[model samples]
Target: MKIRLLSGGVEVRGILLAAVVALGLSATTAAFACEGGSCVNGLAYEAFGPAPGTGSPLLAVFVHGDVSAGGPADYMYSYARQFAASRENVVAIALLRPGYYDRAGKRSDGSDNGRRDTFQSSSNRAVSGAIRELRRMYKARAVVALGHSGGAGTLGVIAGADPGLINGLVLASCPCDVPAWRASRGRGGGYASQSPVDYLSGIPRGTPIVAVTGSSDDNTHPELASNYVAKAQALGLNARLQLVGGGHGFSSGVGGAAVSALGGMAR
Candidate 1:
């Protein structure tokens, strides 16, 4: 439930669980699309920067991995903080994927679907919509997405499905191949989920992609990302894989890798 960042003398010590939190950006659930006669604004996000829409050199959005129902959805806060703190010209956002509610009572709109299988195309639509809204609000020149585990998988799918929307992508411990990942766990996918491998042709050639996975992660095997990168590189995309010597969970090493990917953009 706690996020740890301990790379290069930078230590993110605490979680922002204040009941009365006040960020410059909108604190309410911000949804940008509509489906079935209802507004599709179920995504909640926390941001670090000046008010949205003024101007920023880089806009970075973070999405957390899937967890059990009602689990704390703030594990990616460190990534948000790192992106924001890296440069003054950056606006970093920690987005609660559709249907996720943090302990601080902020819930993003959508069905979490038991936190096991929320990576449906419908969910990606919601996420893409949210990112578009944030980009417009910030008038960002560059957009980068940083995600871990399931969040990484979703972003990987998005990179191919929605090209030109994001300028850079960082995926950590992702199960990019949905069917293979599910079969590895002995679970049949009764729900719908898109595989990043299927969308490789959709990615534009210039976009930069970085996927980092733990050496000891059994949940989302490193080969999953490795295979995805191999294909992406073969297709002329700027994608590479970094194997971290750890587990599947987020750590400072993951945070540093994200910073490396994003810091280049800030410059």
Candidate 2:
């Protein structure tokens, strides 16, 4: 469960080790959310950390893919818990995509939110809005954005829109180049303009990004992840590509890679 940073220096390895230790020692968990008025954009989410006014906290938001198979919240919670454990001043959030869990811990009927753009601008906007709302709610000084599978695409949109919003990003099993993937599926109706690859040039230079995928993954294709790292680096972003042994879902390496990236943000 190690990540070989593509363009990172020797210190990256040490940072990752320290991140692992930090996460191993964390034991605090308390649910949190926006109080009083309705939540931003009516998005549903779960959060863990010290009470909002108790202390300033580093923010980490984890986004999950489709919910057809269920357990999106539980799956993301596992990673969030690990992240929360690593930093005493950190708050971890698991943002459930629209129509998955549109309210606090409540699953929806799996209906589309009446958008023609599907996973295009509409989906991206929703994710970006969630991040913005979370930041506003917590007044976090730093943010680490993480996503898996389809959620990775959403994070890409957020990064491209405003790289400064998150200090670091971790994308696992990302189908960033949507057009190419759609073409491979023998489909003609895909949003080329909304793909993550299309927005790489828009990310702020020097923004830290880590793209990870499994060596055995065919869903997003490991090459896609590598391609994202290459393109981001070409655009002058601090990016890394990690390919671990597994499939399309989150693997142990994915968590380690994210923790390492978050650790790097402090340096």
Candidate 3:
């Protein structure tokens, strides 16, 4: 894992820095369409398997964690690409969340502003907008959302506001309970508004969902995924929790787990 201090002054380590470099290096691939300034709602994105607007079986969008140094889309590029290659006619996209990849100095629909709401409706709107645009552009028959860590919080907001918008979800190492997690971290008053657990009932029932976490993850405990999946299942949602090896960060088997889970989603 090569660590690099990004030009923005954030110390980025591991495959994230490599993924960032991949974005710049793989500009000629099918996934690199947005590198020429083609962005949706000011968000930077890369596509794989098939180009958007050409039609495909599904559009699987991967959203990464809230990291200051690397783009939100950086960490999941390989996973997205691998998944795309495994399936026929699947369009994989890695979308950079607001403030992370400001293409041509354009902020992603008010996302760059520090005052932007974290997990509020505004944040959800930003993510949802990107997904919808990509979905429309690709003419995909179905949509799958893959979110990691804080991105899972954004996924929660999207699921809560528009349950039917996406067909499947993969939330990995999520801080399922924002309030509880915040309180545990000694942050009083907790951002309960951003918690995924709070929006359980809003997610459309039977939406194919897979929530996985590292068995030894201390950042976001494995119990968070277990408890959240329990609640989701109790609500008649097709949700399950899987404990994998490793810690808060990505493990060796996470990509395979995600690909297997997503491959099961109906097209």
lDDT by residue (tens digit), candidate 1, 200-265: 898888888898888888888888989989988999999999887788777736656765776665
TM-score (C-alpha) between model 1 and the true structure: 0.81
Off by over 4 Å in 1: 1-40
- Score every model by TM-score: 0.81, 0.76, 0.77
lDDT of 1 at 201: 91
Off by over 4 Å in 3: 1-37, 68-73, 102-117, 190-193
> How well is each residue in 109-128 modelled by candidate 3, as lDDT tens digits?
44433422255566667788
lDDT score for residue 42 of model 3: 54
Instruction: Name the TM-score of candidate 2.
Output: 0.76
What are the clashing pairs of model 1? Answer: 31-41, 42-108, 42-109, 43-109, 53-137, 53-138
Ranked by TM-score, top first:
1, 3, 2
Please give the lDDT score at residue 19 for candidate 1: 33
Candidate-wise lDDT, in order: 0.78, 0.70, 0.72
lDDT of 2 by residue, 143-191 (tens): 8888887778888877887668877888888888887766665667735
